[model samples]
Target: MSRFLFVVPPLAGHVNAAGAVARALLARGHDVAWVGPESALRRLLGDGVTVYPTGMRPYGGQRDRGARALRSLWEGFVLPFARFTRPAVARAVAAYRPDVVAVDQHALAGALVATAAGLPWASLAPQSMELTEPLRALPRVDAWIRANLAAMWCEAGLPAEEYVDPRFSPHLVLGFTTPALTGPAPFPPHYALVGPALDHDRPDEPDFPWAALDPRRRLVLVTMGTLAEDVARDFYPRLVAALAPLGDRVQAVIAAAPHTVPDPPPHVLVVPRAPVLELLPRVGAVICHAGLNTVCEALAYGIPLVMAPIKHDQPVTAAQVVAAGAGVRVRFGRSRPAELRAALTEVLDSPPYRAAAARVAESFAAAGGAAAAAIHLERLATS
Candidate 1:
């Protein structure tokens, strides 16, 4: 058995997906250690994988307000978080000397560390962050891009230009998205389009009015994801107000993060972030931030979506969903309660939307996620 190290940021989605990949490796008799975030250690340990906790920050605030989301992404991700993580990853890699490192595509620290160690690295992308080329076209983002590249350069012993150039080491990129949902053409040969990695078979103590769910009602699962609790605090209340009109017919299962719960709404069943796989299957539609994890989950379950693509790669992913005909988008900038309500209503009531989503679900079924990942990694070791 070969030693493998998998690096993931602390967020629930990232940890959950990466943990599954690690477990698959372990199950196949490989020595697996997941490195990143103290918060993830408990979960990884429970999944039967060794954990090397690195200090990391979860992005976004409990408030889902636009300003808070933007600030959180800036402070939690593009700033001090990445700066603080590099040395921690370097330390872990030096001590472990893993034969192969499977890292989240956005985990630049892990990528840098693997590059410096001269270890083969494969990207286990939880989102479409590294997929789109249009991100380079953003205004004034090049400065941050250059700074980030310089940091990566220092970490990997490469010139800064290597970061910007399209050519470099052959990276094996595996996306948590079906080919049906991704953008057209120009995909790198090393990149593999895998389906969403469903976290759990089912929840242990699945609660949230499941038994009391109104059969006549259309259930809408409104979530911003586990780490996005802060963002939900700001957004869920507004969302509740928007969907309040459809009260009896449309019951919302609002899974806000702990401490972010608003005043109870009669039509909204508020839970402190339940397992999404459990809740999503029962929902008729989902109103969520365009985090790739949530998007792919909704698609896998054949649930139509209305996305309010907030910070990071959300806008790009949301656009892809619309392009795929599986979902509709609530345009960013001055996005209001009425707009969200309208978008949700339109998608839920539309037959074509559901058909498109179900079609994508078929595509997802064909894409063997964890198993394909296992075979690929096993080959990496054998080769």
Candidate 2:
């Protein structure tokens, strides 16, 4: 049997996606081991997989821009942590001696460890990292390059000369985006579009207050994902204020997150978390942060959206929604109550948004991400 080690950052989205791949690998009679933070241990355990805890929780904070987040990751996590864990990783490699490693793109420790061990490794991209023409044309090109260079130098102890080589490419680069959305890039031979792997076996069916939900009023589900956990803090109040005008005509369900539940607006139902798929079929529209998993989840249900993209790859992901005519993007600085209300109204009122969402839903159905990824990994392991 092929022995594989999958390393992931502590982030839920990363762990969730990696877990899907691990499960697929295990089902194919391969031995799978995950080396990362204890946060992922529970889920991996539930899947009957082995875990090697790294005692490192990745820094999870929202930056104003994607570039800033990347910079922070390099400085805060990679530089210090990779050096600290080098010995531990070395020992793990010697003990387990995995044949291959699949790791999240954000985590450099995995890359370093795998390279040190001389094992084949795959870099997994859970968000949009593919450099686009517009991004490349941005005026602050020099500043961006400087930051990236500085990051690389600090994290990997690499000078400019080292990065020029094609040896930097991982054995495989698995992209988690629908081929329909991302146009082709001239990637390496091993590059594979694995699409969004949202294989969450939702345990603890949270008692969704369906009886409390107003059947007469049109429902709208709002969320900003688990990382941006406390929705009640700042954004939730503003959203409630904006959507309050809809009143009895529209029933808003805000997953305010369990720990910090906000006092609900008159027309809104505040819940910790809802079975997104089960809830989406009854809802007219969704308002969310432009998280990749959330975006894909909404598309899977063919739910039109008003995307309030906060940070990271969100702006770009939101742009895709607008470009596809599937949803409206409520930009960072411009998400006032009135603007949100208008955007939500537009998505609900128009047939085009619904039609666009339906088209993408069809595309996703055709792609069959989970099944495809399972088949691919099975072949890779067996071969």
Candidate 3:
């Protein structure tokens, strides 16, 4: 059996999807392991999983909207974290001796190491990021990103003549979305547009108050993901204000930092965390920051959305949702209560939104998900 090593970032959403695909590999009797932050892997993948320690440095402190956010993301977080973890990833490779490496799009070290070693690797890329080509209009920005990738290649001591963009693997690229959401793509033959990896093999989270849900009320789930908690401080109160006035028809369950929504009305439930996967089935709608993981998860359940995209590929992903008719978007920080309310009402009450979501869900099923990702990885390994 081929050995597969998954190299991912410390971020939970990245790990969650990787964990699903890793488990799928294991089920087929291949050996699978991970190289990333031990604490995060243990928290998400459980203590039993093998994780090579790559000392964690948190994401960049600068969280905002637009081009500035993109700069901070690469310079502050991606490139820095890549340099920090390169040694550990190389060490993990030497020790595990994997036949194939699976690398997240942001985990540049994996591609660098595998390529330098003359081993095949597959990019577990986000549809919102590489597949969407969000930076095509910003030619300078695109060149800036490529130059950094080239620098990282040079730092790995690989020859400049043999350079390739580490964020994308030449062997295979597994995207976490389908053309149904991304529109038709210009990607090559090796781009595998597997749907959201819904196997989500993590252990069950049982703490959510299922009884607190009102059977008669149309339920909405609001989550900005863990990374967006601090940035969401002001957004929550405005969100609360928007949803508060709509209590006659809707109640919201917000997964947020403590006290973000102070004195939340009985119709709203604000918690330190919520069992999102478990809660998705019961909810009719979602209000999110348009993080790809959240968007895919909400869509997997065929739930419509109201998106507020803050940074990076989120805005692009939000646009895709709007184009697909699965959701509507609002300004992240500047959205007034009336606007937020209107967007929420549009998705929650509109039949077209739910119908569109279901259509996307059907496409996702047809594309296959974790199983398809595993099949691609296996072929890359065996080929």
Candidate 4:
């Protein structure tokens, strides 16, 4: 059995995706370990797993508006994160000496260190951003990103010429979405489109009042994802008000920050968190921030969406959803209650949206999920 080390960022979504693959590897009789923030990994993967803590700073906040968003992503989070984690990851590698490393896409330092050490590594892309042409469309931005990555590699004493995109592994790249959701894209032979690695055995089921939900009314889930709680505060009330008109005909479940909305309308259920996987099966449509994980989860259950993209890869993911005929997109900051209600109504009332979502669901199932990801990692380790 080969020993595998997973290097991930502190982000919950990235950790969850990597954890799914780690569980699959362990089930296959391979020894697995993690190199990341210890507390966060323990919370996501449970206490049984071994972890080498490389505590790094959390991703800082970014401005939600203007052309500066991408700049802020690099300056505020990406570059700083890599710089901070590089030494820690290098230390972890020396101490653990695993056969192969599974590197989260955002954690570029892991890949750089592993490559420098001549160990096989795979890139875990929780989001499908690398598969899309967002950067290619903007050549200058793409060049700027590449330059920064090259500089980072050079500073770490690794060959800068070897760097193409740190997010794409030289050995393997595991994308967590299928072409059905992302549409067709030209990817390299090493890239594998393994669908979202959703953990089916997670024990933390939220105490949702499932019995209280009316079966007669169509259910809808509204969430701005984990990172957007502060940015989406003002938007939540508008969303609640918009969906309130449906009253008994439609029931809305809004997941926001704790105490963000004290008194929601009668038709809306405001909670700090919702067991989204458990709730998706009963819901007809989802209104979300177009986060890759949330979008994939909703689509996995064949539920259509109303996407409001705030920043980062959200706009790209939302575009894919709209292009696939599975959802509608709206501006997050400017969208009014009337617009949100109209978009939600379209997703819920239209049969085509449901059909498209079902089609994506089939593709996701075919992509083989955590099992497929494990197989690829195993191949990398043994090859």
Q: Using TM-score as the measure, which candidate wins? A: 3
Error of 2 at 335 (Å): 2.3
The TM-scores of all predictions, comma-separated, are 0.86, 0.84, 0.97, 0.95
- Weakest 10 consecutive residues of candidate 3 by summed lDDT: 198-207
Once model 1 is optimally superposed onto the true structure by TM-score, how far is the C-alpha of residue 260 displaced, in angstroms?
4.9
Best-to-worst TM-score order? 3, 4, 1, 2
lDDT of 3 by residue, 1-383 (tens): 99999999977788888888998898999999999988878888888888889988766686756887887888888899889999999999999999999999889999999988889999998548667784886677788988988988999999999998887788999999999999987889998999899763476343777888998889999998777877888998888889888887787899887677777888998887888888888899999989888999999889999999888888889999999999999999899999999998888889999999999999899988998899999999999
> Tens digits of per-residue lDDT for model 2 on 1-383?
78878776666667777777777777777788877665556643464556676776445444434566545545665455555555565566677888877767666566666765557777777776432222453436435544654564446544555442111334566766665555555656666776666665643235787888888888999988775653326677667777888995899988766445456677888887777767877988999988777787788778888988765667777877777788998864457778888989999999999999888777777765656665655555455
- Candidate 2's displacement at residue 98, Å, is 2.2
Candidate no. 1 TM-score? 0.86
Candidate 4 Cα errors over 4 Å, as ranges? 203-205
User: Candidate 1 at 50: error in angstroms?
Assistant: 1.1
Q: Where is model 2 more than 4 Å wrong at Cα?
A: 43-47, 57-70, 78-86, 130-169, 184-188, 203-207, 229-232, 257-262
Q: Rank the candidates by lDDT, best first.
A: 3, 4, 1, 2
Which 10-residue window of candidate 4 scores lowest in summed lDDT? 62-71
Off by over 4 Å in 3: 204-206
Clash pairs, model 1 backbone: 61-230, 61-231, 62-230, 63-230, 63-234, 64-231, 64-234
lDDT of 1 at 250: 90
Candidate 4 residue lDDT tens string, 250-333: 988988775776578777888778888888889999999898999999999999999998877788899999999999999898
**Greater-TM-score candidate between 3 and 4:** 3
Clashing pairs in 2: none
